[model samples]
Target: MAHFLSESELSKIESEKGKESVKRAVKSKTADVDNEMRDIREQRARLVEERKKKRPQTTDKRTIAEIHKEKREVQDEIRRIQDSISCDAKIVLPEHEST
Candidate 1:
């Protein structure tokens, strides 16, 4: 037999579903950001070590190019994280109708 729910009940169910979806999305996004931040921090630490080995070397164009490449990679990572969070927020899980 088919049953009907009142408007308030329907709305409440929808609100709950939406809240849960948002919570999951936020958690996923937070995890991704934390992982990426850790990776970037590790890379920066390595860069620092490279800088500290003050083996007075000539200014090489390749070093300059590598630095720029690293900078761009970091920027891209940040942008990807932001996009992931935003995309996650836009997702709406299909609501299951109550029996």
Candidate 2:
């Protein structure tokens, strides 16, 4: 005879699978956002260092604006990353919820 899962066991298995799927999707999105944020931050840092070395008094408004924009974009990217991967790591099975 073939083994079969009881109704409760089947429901638990389905719930676990759904949670795993959500976790994987979140991780993939977070990774992409993190990489983009890192690149933008590095570029902004380079621009700041270059400005410090070359221009002591002369201030270019456009360059400053560009750097600010980059900083904003990086901040936005980090927030997006946080939103995507903010799920609870500790998963409690539904069957044990009543206890």
Candidate 3:
């Protein structure tokens, strides 16, 4: 049975479809960002461990400075990716929506 839809209904349907596409795109992008963040975090952890192993007692100024700088860089990267993920957080659509 063919039931005609009003203009408003058709418009709403189109809008919903557009939103769905946008949501899917956002989800995929978020996943990628999340993976990047995870990698960065792992790198940071490794850096920390390396630093610890190098100096179990005395802090070498040059080595400490270099490790600190690297830590800051990794932290910055994590923060940037976190912000990117949160920026699109409003559109992280659920698996399904009930009409």
lDDT of 2 by residue, 1-99 (tens): 123345675567558778676566556656777787888899899999998999768568999999999999999999988765654322433445745
Give me candidate 2's TM-score against the actual structure.
0.35
Superposition error at 36 for model 2 (Å): 1.4
Give candidate 3's error at residue 80 in angstroms.
67
Alpha-carbon lDDT, every model: 0.74, 0.71, 0.75
Worst 10 residues of 1 by lDDT: 90-99
How many Å off is the CA of 9 in candidate 1? 26
Alpha-carbon TM-score of each model against the true structure: 0.37, 0.35, 0.39
lDDT of 3 by residue, 24-59 (tens): 655665677778788889999999999999975977
Ranking by lDDT: 3, 1, 2
Candidate achieving the largest TM-score: 3
User: For residues 1-99, what per-residue lDDT tens digits would candidate 1 score against the true structure?
Assistant: 223445775566558778677566556656777787888899999999988896576778999999999999999999999998877656643245323
Candidate that beats the other on lDDT, 2 or 3, i.e. the better one = 3
Candidate 3 error regions (>4 Å): 1-17, 59-99
